[model samples]
Target: MPDRDPLIRVTAMPADTNPYGGVFGGWLMSQMALGAGSLASRVGKGKAVVVSATDFAFPGAMAVGDELSVYCEIAATGTTSLTITAEGIARERNGEATVKVAQGTFKFVLLDENDRPREVAL
Candidate 1:
Protein backbone atom coordinates (compact mmCIF):
# COMPACT_ATOMS: atom_id res chain seq x y z
CA MET A 1 0.00 0.00 0.00
CA PRO A 2 3.04 2.26 0.12
CA ASP A 3 3.33 2.30 -3.68
CA ARG A 4 5.94 -0.43 -4.05
CA ASP A 5 5.46 -2.91 -6.85
CA PRO A 6 3.41 -5.96 -5.95
CA LEU A 7 5.06 -9.33 -6.40
CA ILE A 8 2.34 -11.80 -5.54
CA ARG A 9 -1.34 -11.86 -4.65
CA VAL A 10 -3.40 -14.59 -3.02
CA THR A 11 -6.55 -15.05 -1.03
CA ALA A 12 -6.60 -16.42 2.48
CA MET A 13 -8.74 -19.51 2.36
CA PRO A 14 -10.46 -21.60 5.01
CA ALA A 15 -7.78 -24.24 4.79
CA ASP A 16 -5.12 -21.63 5.42
CA THR A 17 -6.92 -20.31 8.46
CA ASN A 18 -6.13 -21.21 12.04
CA PRO A 19 -8.68 -22.28 14.65
CA TYR A 20 -9.41 -18.61 15.17
CA GLY A 21 -10.08 -18.07 11.45
CA GLY A 22 -6.86 -16.24 10.83
CA VAL A 23 -4.33 -17.24 8.25
CA PHE A 24 -1.41 -19.28 9.55
CA GLY A 25 2.00 -17.65 9.82
CA GLY A 26 3.66 -20.57 8.08
CA TRP A 27 1.48 -20.12 5.04
CA LEU A 28 2.37 -16.45 4.78
CA MET A 29 6.04 -17.23 5.27
CA SER A 30 5.94 -19.76 2.45
CA GLN A 31 4.46 -17.15 0.18
CA MET A 32 7.23 -14.74 1.03
CA ALA A 33 9.81 -17.42 0.25
CA LEU A 34 8.24 -18.04 -3.13
CA GLY A 35 8.26 -14.34 -3.93
CA ALA A 36 11.83 -13.83 -2.79
CA GLY A 37 13.01 -16.94 -4.59
CA SER A 38 11.33 -15.93 -7.78
CA LEU A 39 13.04 -12.54 -7.81
CA ALA A 40 16.40 -14.02 -6.87
CA SER A 41 16.21 -16.60 -9.63
CA ARG A 42 15.33 -13.99 -12.18
CA VAL A 43 18.32 -11.89 -11.20
CA GLY A 44 20.62 -14.87 -10.74
CA LYS A 45 19.48 -16.32 -14.05
CA GLY A 46 19.07 -19.77 -12.55
CA LYS A 47 17.78 -21.74 -9.61
CA ALA A 48 18.25 -20.43 -6.11
CA VAL A 49 18.01 -21.69 -2.55
CA VAL A 50 16.83 -19.84 0.51
CA VAL A 51 19.67 -19.59 2.97
CA SER A 52 18.16 -17.46 5.68
CA ALA A 53 15.31 -15.35 6.84
CA THR A 54 17.35 -12.47 8.15
CA ASP A 55 14.34 -10.67 9.53
CA PHE A 56 10.62 -11.19 9.94
CA ALA A 57 7.71 -9.40 11.55
CA PHE A 58 3.95 -9.61 11.67
CA PRO A 59 2.15 -6.31 12.01
CA GLY A 60 -1.37 -7.73 11.95
CA ALA A 61 -3.50 -10.79 11.34
CA MET A 62 -4.84 -12.12 8.07
CA ALA A 63 -8.35 -13.43 8.31
CA VAL A 64 -10.01 -15.85 5.96
CA GLY A 65 -11.19 -14.13 2.74
CA ASP A 66 -8.62 -11.41 3.03
CA GLU A 67 -6.74 -10.53 -0.11
CA LEU A 68 -3.02 -10.78 0.42
CA SER A 69 -0.39 -9.08 -1.69
CA VAL A 70 3.33 -9.78 -1.50
CA TYR A 71 5.95 -7.30 -2.67
CA CYS A 72 9.60 -8.20 -3.15
CA GLU A 73 12.75 -6.46 -4.32
CA ILE A 74 16.43 -7.25 -4.31
CA ALA A 75 18.12 -5.55 -1.42
CA ALA A 76 21.62 -6.82 -2.00
CA THR A 77 23.67 -9.22 -4.07
CA GLY A 78 26.70 -11.32 -3.38
CA THR A 79 29.00 -13.36 -5.60
CA THR A 80 26.54 -16.21 -5.56
CA SER A 81 23.73 -14.99 -3.39
CA LEU A 82 21.10 -12.32 -2.98
CA THR A 83 19.10 -10.70 -0.22
CA ILE A 84 15.54 -9.62 -0.77
CA THR A 85 13.07 -7.60 1.22
CA ALA A 86 9.44 -8.60 1.07
CA GLU A 87 6.25 -7.16 2.50
CA GLY A 88 2.86 -8.78 2.69
CA ILE A 89 -0.20 -6.56 2.75
CA ALA A 90 -3.59 -7.85 3.75
CA ARG A 91 -6.77 -6.12 2.69
CA GLU A 92 -10.34 -7.06 3.35
CA ARG A 93 -12.80 -7.47 0.51
CA ASN A 94 -14.78 -4.42 1.54
CA GLY A 95 -12.54 -2.61 3.97
CA GLU A 96 -9.35 -0.54 3.80
CA ALA A 97 -5.83 -1.86 4.11
CA THR A 98 -5.27 -2.31 7.82
CA VAL A 99 -1.95 -4.02 8.20
CA LYS A 100 1.21 -5.45 6.81
CA VAL A 101 0.59 -9.00 7.87
CA ALA A 102 4.20 -9.97 7.26
CA GLN A 103 7.55 -8.58 6.21
CA GLY A 104 11.11 -9.93 6.08
CA THR A 105 14.49 -10.17 4.49
CA PHE A 106 15.18 -13.45 2.69
CA LYS A 107 18.61 -14.59 1.50
CA PHE A 108 19.08 -16.93 -1.43
CA VAL A 109 22.11 -18.44 -3.10
CA LEU A 110 22.36 -18.97 -6.79
CA LEU A 111 22.99 -22.55 -7.89
CA ASP A 112 24.51 -24.09 -10.98
CA GLU A 113 23.73 -27.29 -12.87
CA ASN A 114 25.28 -29.36 -10.15
CA ASP A 115 23.48 -27.44 -7.42
CA ARG A 116 26.55 -25.58 -6.37
CA PRO A 117 26.92 -21.89 -5.74
CA ARG A 118 27.78 -19.82 -8.79
CA GLU A 119 28.32 -16.19 -9.55
CA VAL A 120 25.09 -14.29 -9.60
CA ALA A 121 24.06 -13.47 -13.14
CA LEU A 122 23.04 -10.01 -12.18
Candidate 2:
Protein backbone atom coordinates (compact mmCIF):
# COMPACT_ATOMS: atom_id res chain seq x y z
CA MET A 1 0.00 0.00 0.00
CA PRO A 2 1.10 3.56 -0.64
CA ASP A 3 1.93 5.90 2.21
CA ARG A 4 -0.50 8.51 0.94
CA ASP A 5 -4.24 8.13 0.65
CA PRO A 6 -5.73 7.16 -2.69
CA LEU A 7 -7.85 9.59 -4.66
CA ILE A 8 -10.31 6.86 -5.56
CA ARG A 9 -10.76 3.32 -4.33
CA VAL A 10 -13.20 0.65 -5.32
CA THR A 11 -13.56 -3.08 -5.58
CA ALA A 12 -13.26 -4.85 -8.94
CA MET A 13 -16.60 -6.47 -9.52
CA PRO A 14 -17.35 -9.30 -11.93
CA ALA A 15 -18.92 -6.76 -14.23
CA ASP A 16 -15.55 -5.06 -14.56
CA THR A 17 -13.91 -8.18 -15.92
CA ASN A 18 -12.92 -8.76 -19.52
CA PRO A 19 -13.65 -11.75 -21.69
CA TYR A 20 -10.73 -13.56 -20.13
CA GLY A 21 -12.13 -12.98 -16.65
CA GLY A 22 -9.40 -10.57 -15.65
CA VAL A 23 -10.05 -6.99 -14.72
CA PHE A 24 -10.39 -4.90 -17.88
CA GLY A 25 -7.64 -2.50 -18.78
CA GLY A 26 -10.18 0.08 -19.97
CA TRP A 27 -11.86 -0.03 -16.60
CA LEU A 28 -8.54 0.61 -14.89
CA MET A 29 -7.82 3.52 -17.21
CA SER A 30 -11.22 5.04 -16.53
CA GLN A 31 -10.57 4.78 -12.82
CA MET A 32 -7.25 6.56 -13.22
CA ALA A 33 -8.90 9.27 -15.31
CA LEU A 34 -11.55 9.79 -12.66
CA GLY A 35 -8.89 10.28 -10.03
CA ALA A 36 -6.78 12.60 -12.16
CA GLY A 37 -9.80 14.66 -13.17
CA SER A 38 -10.82 15.03 -9.55
CA LEU A 39 -7.42 16.37 -8.60
CA ALA A 40 -7.30 18.70 -11.58
CA SER A 41 -10.72 20.15 -10.84
CA ARG A 42 -9.84 20.67 -7.18
CA VAL A 43 -6.57 22.40 -7.94
CA GLY A 44 -7.99 24.45 -10.78
CA LYS A 45 -11.03 25.39 -8.71
CA GLY A 46 -13.32 24.70 -11.66
CA LYS A 47 -14.13 22.19 -14.34
CA ALA A 48 -11.28 20.39 -16.04
CA VAL A 49 -11.39 18.19 -19.08
CA VAL A 50 -8.87 15.70 -20.31
CA VAL A 51 -6.88 16.96 -23.24
CA SER A 52 -4.48 14.09 -23.59
CA ALA A 53 -3.63 10.79 -21.96
CA THR A 54 -0.45 8.87 -22.58
CA ASP A 55 2.23 6.59 -21.19
CA PHE A 56 -0.23 3.95 -20.18
CA ALA A 57 1.22 0.65 -19.03
CA PHE A 58 -0.27 -2.39 -17.41
CA PRO A 59 2.45 -3.85 -15.26
CA GLY A 60 0.27 -6.36 -13.44
CA ALA A 61 -3.17 -7.89 -13.35
CA MET A 62 -6.09 -7.94 -10.93
CA ALA A 63 -9.03 -10.28 -10.59
CA VAL A 64 -12.62 -9.67 -9.71
CA GLY A 65 -13.21 -8.98 -5.99
CA ASP A 66 -9.79 -7.31 -5.65
CA GLU A 67 -9.63 -3.80 -4.31
CA LEU A 68 -8.31 -1.12 -6.67
CA SER A 69 -6.92 2.16 -5.47
CA VAL A 70 -6.08 5.02 -7.81
CA TYR A 71 -3.55 7.60 -6.70
CA CYS A 72 -3.02 10.85 -8.57
CA GLU A 73 -0.72 13.84 -8.28
CA ILE A 74 -0.13 16.94 -10.30
CA ALA A 75 3.10 16.45 -12.20
CA ALA A 76 3.09 19.82 -13.90
CA THR A 77 0.91 22.86 -14.30
CA GLY A 78 0.53 25.22 -17.21
CA THR A 79 -1.41 28.39 -17.73
CA THR A 80 -4.57 26.49 -18.50
CA SER A 81 -3.64 22.87 -18.10
CA LEU A 82 -2.53 20.38 -15.49
CA THR A 83 -0.49 17.27 -16.07
CA ILE A 84 -1.46 14.55 -13.62
CA THR A 85 0.20 11.22 -13.05
CA ALA A 86 -2.04 8.40 -11.91
CA GLU A 87 -1.21 4.95 -10.60
CA GLY A 88 -3.52 2.09 -9.87
CA ILE A 89 -2.73 -0.49 -7.23
CA ALA A 90 -4.61 -3.70 -6.65
CA ARG A 91 -4.88 -5.64 -3.44
CA GLU A 92 -5.74 -9.26 -3.30
CA ARG A 93 -9.32 -10.09 -2.52
CA ASN A 94 -8.57 -12.04 0.63
CA GLY A 95 -5.00 -11.26 1.49
CA GLU A 96 -2.42 -8.52 1.90
CA ALA A 97 -0.73 -8.98 -1.48
CA THR A 98 -0.71 -5.77 -3.45
CA VAL A 99 0.69 -4.86 -6.86
CA LYS A 100 1.01 -1.89 -9.13
CA VAL A 101 -1.38 -2.73 -11.90
CA ALA A 102 -1.57 0.37 -14.08
CA GLN A 103 -0.10 3.82 -14.54
CA GLY A 104 -0.49 6.78 -16.92
CA THR A 105 -0.29 10.52 -17.34
CA PHE A 106 -3.26 12.69 -18.13
CA LYS A 107 -3.34 16.30 -19.24
CA PHE A 108 -6.40 18.29 -18.27
CA VAL A 109 -7.38 21.78 -19.35
CA LEU A 110 -9.28 23.98 -16.95
CA LEU A 111 -12.63 25.09 -18.25
CA ASP A 112 -14.97 27.94 -17.46
CA GLU A 113 -18.74 27.86 -17.10
CA ASN A 114 -19.08 28.08 -20.87
CA ASP A 115 -16.84 24.99 -21.30
CA ARG A 116 -14.01 26.97 -22.79
CA PRO A 117 -10.44 26.63 -21.61
CA ARG A 118 -9.54 29.02 -18.85
CA GLU A 119 -6.46 29.84 -16.87
CA VAL A 120 -5.91 27.84 -13.74
CA ALA A 121 -6.54 29.60 -10.47
CA LEU A 122 -3.14 28.82 -9.08
Candidate 3:
Protein backbone atom coordinates (compact mmCIF):
# COMPACT_ATOMS: atom_id res chain seq x y z
CA MET A 1 0.00 0.00 0.00
CA PRO A 2 1.15 3.53 -0.66
CA ASP A 3 2.21 5.63 2.33
CA ARG A 4 0.40 8.59 0.82
CA ASP A 5 -3.31 8.37 0.22
CA PRO A 6 -4.60 7.47 -3.22
CA LEU A 7 -5.65 10.23 -5.58
CA ILE A 8 -8.67 8.19 -6.55
CA ARG A 9 -10.24 4.86 -5.52
CA VAL A 10 -12.90 2.97 -7.38
CA THR A 11 -14.46 -0.48 -7.50
CA ALA A 12 -14.29 -2.50 -10.66
CA MET A 13 -17.69 -3.32 -12.04
CA PRO A 14 -19.16 -5.64 -14.64
CA ALA A 15 -19.15 -2.89 -17.22
CA ASP A 16 -15.48 -2.33 -16.62
CA THR A 17 -14.62 -5.86 -17.78
CA ASN A 18 -13.14 -6.79 -21.07
CA PRO A 19 -14.66 -9.26 -23.49
CA TYR A 20 -12.90 -12.08 -21.64
CA GLY A 21 -14.62 -11.02 -18.40
CA GLY A 22 -11.49 -9.63 -16.78
CA VAL A 23 -10.93 -6.02 -15.88
CA PHE A 24 -10.04 -3.88 -18.89
CA GLY A 25 -6.67 -2.27 -19.16
CA GLY A 26 -8.09 0.78 -20.91
CA TRP A 27 -10.41 1.45 -18.01
CA LEU A 28 -7.54 1.20 -15.61
CA MET A 29 -5.49 3.60 -17.67
CA SER A 30 -8.34 6.08 -17.82
CA GLN A 31 -8.69 5.97 -14.07
CA MET A 32 -5.01 6.65 -13.64
CA ALA A 33 -5.23 9.55 -16.09
CA LEU A 34 -8.12 11.02 -14.13
CA GLY A 35 -6.13 10.84 -10.93
CA ALA A 36 -3.06 12.34 -12.57
CA GLY A 37 -5.14 15.14 -14.05
CA SER A 38 -6.58 15.97 -10.66
CA LEU A 39 -3.11 16.29 -9.21
CA ALA A 40 -1.93 18.38 -12.15
CA SER A 41 -4.77 20.82 -11.73
CA ARG A 42 -4.19 21.11 -7.99
CA VAL A 43 -0.43 21.47 -8.24
CA GLY A 44 -0.66 23.90 -11.11
CA LYS A 45 -3.24 25.93 -9.15
CA GLY A 46 -5.28 26.28 -12.33
CA LYS A 47 -5.97 24.50 -15.60
CA ALA A 48 -3.52 21.93 -16.86
CA VAL A 49 -3.61 19.79 -19.95
CA VAL A 50 -1.75 16.59 -20.58
CA VAL A 51 0.80 17.12 -23.30
CA SER A 52 2.22 13.61 -23.23
CA ALA A 53 1.67 10.21 -21.68
CA THR A 54 4.29 7.51 -21.95
CA ASP A 55 6.04 4.48 -20.45
CA PHE A 56 2.85 2.63 -19.72
CA ALA A 57 3.20 -0.86 -18.30
CA PHE A 58 0.74 -3.44 -17.04
CA PRO A 59 2.38 -5.81 -14.64
CA GLY A 60 -0.71 -7.51 -13.23
CA ALA A 61 -4.29 -8.37 -13.86
CA MET A 62 -7.49 -7.74 -11.96
CA ALA A 63 -11.06 -8.96 -11.92
CA VAL A 64 -14.47 -7.43 -11.65
CA GLY A 65 -15.55 -6.61 -8.11
CA ASP A 66 -11.99 -5.79 -7.16
CA GLU A 67 -11.10 -2.35 -5.91
CA LEU A 68 -8.67 -0.15 -7.80
CA SER A 69 -6.64 2.64 -6.28
CA VAL A 70 -4.62 5.19 -8.22
CA TYR A 71 -1.60 6.89 -6.71
CA CYS A 72 0.19 9.83 -8.29
CA GLU A 73 3.13 12.05 -7.52
CA ILE A 74 4.82 14.97 -9.18
CA ALA A 75 8.01 13.41 -10.41
CA ALA A 76 9.40 16.60 -11.86
CA THR A 77 8.57 20.25 -12.28
CA GLY A 78 9.52 22.41 -15.22
CA THR A 79 9.08 26.06 -16.03
CA THR A 80 5.68 25.37 -17.57
CA SER A 81 5.05 21.70 -16.95
CA LEU A 82 4.73 19.07 -14.29
CA THR A 83 5.63 15.45 -14.84
CA ILE A 84 3.45 13.06 -12.88
CA THR A 85 3.96 9.37 -12.35
CA ALA A 86 0.92 7.24 -11.71
CA GLU A 87 0.42 3.69 -10.42
CA GLY A 88 -2.65 1.55 -10.22
CA ILE A 89 -3.14 -1.07 -7.55
CA ALA A 90 -5.91 -3.59 -7.33
CA ARG A 91 -7.09 -5.24 -4.13
CA GLU A 92 -9.14 -8.39 -4.00
CA ARG A 93 -12.80 -7.66 -3.45
CA ASN A 94 -13.15 -9.94 -0.48
CA GLY A 95 -9.66 -9.97 0.95
CA GLU A 96 -6.65 -7.79 1.65
CA ALA A 97 -4.45 -9.13 -1.13
CA THR A 98 -3.24 -6.43 -3.50
CA VAL A 99 -1.18 -6.18 -6.67
CA LYS A 100 0.29 -3.41 -8.75
CA VAL A 101 -1.64 -3.39 -11.98
CA ALA A 102 -0.32 -0.52 -14.06
CA GLN A 103 2.02 2.45 -14.25
CA GLY A 104 2.69 5.37 -16.57
CA THR A 105 4.05 8.89 -16.79
CA PHE A 106 2.14 11.99 -17.78
CA LYS A 107 3.43 15.47 -18.55
CA PHE A 108 1.02 18.34 -18.20
CA VAL A 109 1.49 21.95 -19.17
CA LEU A 110 0.02 24.53 -16.90
CA LEU A 111 -2.46 26.73 -18.74
CA ASP A 112 -3.34 30.34 -18.19
CA GLU A 113 -6.83 31.81 -18.44
CA ASN A 114 -6.41 32.20 -22.17
CA ASP A 115 -5.26 28.55 -22.48
CA ARG A 116 -1.66 29.37 -23.19
CA PRO A 117 1.09 27.56 -21.35
CA ARG A 118 2.05 29.42 -18.21
CA GLU A 119 5.10 29.23 -16.04
CA VAL A 120 4.90 26.78 -13.19
CA ALA A 121 5.04 28.91 -10.07
CA LEU A 122 6.01 26.20 -7.60
Candidate 4:
Protein backbone atom coordinates (compact mmCIF):
# COMPACT_ATOMS: atom_id res chain seq x y z
CA MET A 1 0.00 0.00 0.00
CA PRO A 2 1.46 3.38 -0.96
CA ASP A 3 0.77 6.70 0.72
CA ARG A 4 -1.64 8.95 -1.11
CA ASP A 5 -4.16 11.72 -0.52
CA PRO A 6 -7.89 11.33 -0.14
CA LEU A 7 -9.86 10.78 -3.33
CA ILE A 8 -13.25 12.01 -2.17
CA ARG A 9 -14.64 13.86 0.85
CA VAL A 10 -18.25 14.66 1.57
CA THR A 11 -20.43 15.30 4.56
CA ALA A 12 -23.02 12.82 5.70
CA MET A 13 -26.38 14.15 4.69
CA PRO A 14 -29.97 13.39 5.63
CA ALA A 15 -30.62 12.10 2.14
CA ASP A 16 -28.01 9.42 2.60
CA THR A 17 -29.40 8.14 5.89
CA ASN A 18 -31.54 5.13 6.50
CA PRO A 19 -34.73 5.01 8.53
CA TYR A 20 -32.60 4.59 11.62
CA GLY A 21 -30.87 7.90 10.91
CA GLY A 22 -27.50 6.27 10.36
CA VAL A 23 -25.65 6.29 7.09
CA PHE A 24 -26.62 3.40 4.85
CA GLY A 25 -24.11 0.70 4.13
CA GLY A 26 -25.04 0.56 0.45
CA TRP A 27 -24.60 4.31 0.14
CA LEU A 28 -21.15 4.11 1.68
CA MET A 29 -20.25 1.31 -0.66
CA SER A 30 -21.31 3.35 -3.65
CA GLN A 31 -19.13 6.23 -2.55
CA MET A 32 -16.22 3.88 -2.09
CA ALA A 33 -16.78 2.48 -5.57
CA LEU A 34 -16.88 5.94 -7.08
CA GLY A 35 -13.68 6.91 -5.32
CA ALA A 36 -11.88 3.79 -6.44
CA GLY A 37 -13.29 4.12 -9.93
CA SER A 38 -12.06 7.68 -10.21
CA LEU A 39 -8.53 6.71 -9.26
CA ALA A 40 -8.59 3.68 -11.53
CA SER A 41 -9.86 5.71 -14.48
CA ARG A 42 -7.11 8.25 -14.04
CA VAL A 43 -4.47 5.54 -13.88
CA GLY A 44 -5.96 3.72 -16.85
CA LYS A 45 -6.19 7.00 -18.78
CA GLY A 46 -9.79 6.31 -19.71
CA LYS A 47 -13.12 5.01 -18.41
CA ALA A 48 -13.19 1.90 -16.29
CA VAL A 49 -15.60 -0.77 -15.08
CA VAL A 50 -15.80 -2.22 -11.59
CA VAL A 51 -15.07 -5.90 -12.05
CA SER A 52 -15.09 -6.92 -8.44
CA ALA A 53 -14.95 -5.77 -4.84
CA THR A 54 -12.29 -7.97 -3.31
CA ASP A 55 -12.89 -7.02 0.30
CA PHE A 56 -15.36 -4.80 2.10
CA ALA A 57 -15.56 -4.25 5.81
CA PHE A 58 -17.35 -1.80 8.03
CA PRO A 59 -15.56 -1.12 11.27
CA GLY A 60 -17.57 1.82 12.57
CA ALA A 61 -20.83 3.66 12.26
CA MET A 62 -21.51 7.02 10.65
CA ALA A 63 -23.91 9.75 11.67
CA VAL A 64 -25.36 12.85 10.10
CA GLY A 65 -22.81 15.30 11.46
CA ASP A 66 -19.80 13.28 10.56
CA GLU A 67 -17.32 14.41 7.95
CA LEU A 68 -16.67 11.39 5.77
CA SER A 69 -13.67 11.00 3.53
CA VAL A 70 -12.68 8.32 1.03
CA TYR A 71 -9.02 7.70 0.34
CA CYS A 72 -7.85 5.61 -2.58
CA GLU A 73 -4.63 4.65 -4.32
CA ILE A 74 -3.52 2.19 -6.93
CA ALA A 75 -2.58 -1.20 -5.61
CA ALA A 76 -1.77 -2.98 -8.86
CA THR A 77 -2.21 -2.71 -12.60
CA GLY A 78 -3.01 -5.61 -14.89
CA THR A 79 -3.00 -5.77 -18.68
CA THR A 80 -6.51 -4.27 -18.87
CA SER A 81 -7.44 -3.70 -15.27
CA LEU A 82 -6.33 -1.76 -12.22
CA THR A 83 -6.88 -2.59 -8.59
CA ILE A 84 -7.35 0.09 -5.96
CA THR A 85 -7.86 0.07 -2.25
CA ALA A 86 -10.33 2.52 -0.81
CA GLU A 87 -10.89 3.50 2.80
CA GLY A 88 -13.68 5.46 4.40
CA ILE A 89 -13.07 7.55 7.50
CA ALA A 90 -15.37 9.75 9.45
CA ARG A 91 -14.68 12.51 11.95
CA GLU A 92 -17.15 14.09 14.28
CA ARG A 93 -17.94 17.67 13.47
CA ASN A 94 -16.49 18.86 16.75
CA GLY A 95 -13.35 16.76 16.72
CA GLU A 96 -10.18 16.53 14.64
CA ALA A 97 -9.60 12.83 15.03
CA THR A 98 -11.09 10.52 12.43
CA VAL A 99 -12.22 6.91 12.76
CA LYS A 100 -12.04 4.34 10.04
CA VAL A 101 -15.56 3.35 9.10
CA ALA A 102 -15.08 1.02 6.18
CA GLN A 103 -12.62 -0.19 3.58
CA GLY A 104 -12.67 -2.19 0.36
CA THR A 105 -10.44 -3.21 -2.53
CA PHE A 106 -12.00 -2.93 -5.97
CA LYS A 107 -10.83 -4.03 -9.40
CA PHE A 108 -11.57 -1.88 -12.42
CA VAL A 109 -11.08 -2.70 -16.07
CA LEU A 110 -10.50 -0.11 -18.70
CA LEU A 111 -13.41 0.47 -21.09
CA ASP A 112 -13.78 1.98 -24.52
CA GLU A 113 -16.46 4.46 -25.58
CA ASN A 114 -18.78 1.63 -26.54
CA ASP A 115 -18.43 0.13 -23.07
CA ARG A 116 -16.19 -2.63 -24.26
CA PRO A 117 -12.96 -3.71 -22.62
CA ARG A 118 -9.78 -1.98 -23.78
CA GLU A 119 -6.13 -2.36 -23.03
CA VAL A 120 -5.06 -0.05 -20.26
CA ALA A 121 -2.40 2.55 -20.87
CA LEU A 122 -0.20 1.16 -18.16
Winning candidate number (lDDT): 2
Return model 4's CA RMSD, one decimal: 2.3
lDDT of 3 at 118: 98
Pick by TM-score: which candidate is best?
2
Give TM-scores for every candidate, taking all chains together and pairing residue i with residue i: 0.92, 0.98, 0.96, 0.90
- Per-candidate clashes come to 0, 0, 0, 0
TM-score of 3: 0.96
Which residue pairs overlap in candidate 2's backbone? none
* Candidate 3 local lDDT, 18-104, one digit each (tens): 999988989998999999999999989999998999999999999989999999999999999999999999999999999999999
lDDT of each: 0.87, 0.96, 0.95, 0.86
- Writing each residue's lDDT as its tens digit, candidate 1 over 3-28 gives 77677788888999777777999899
CA deviation > 4 Å runs, candidate 1 = none
Off by over 4 Å in 3: none
Clashing pairs in 1: none
Residue 57 lDDT in candidate 4: 94
RMSD to true structure for each model, in Å:
1.3, 0.7, 0.8, 2.3
* Candidate 1 C-alpha error for residue 35, in Å: 0.8
- List the lowest-lDDT window of 10 residues for candidate 3: 1-10
TM-score of 1: 0.92
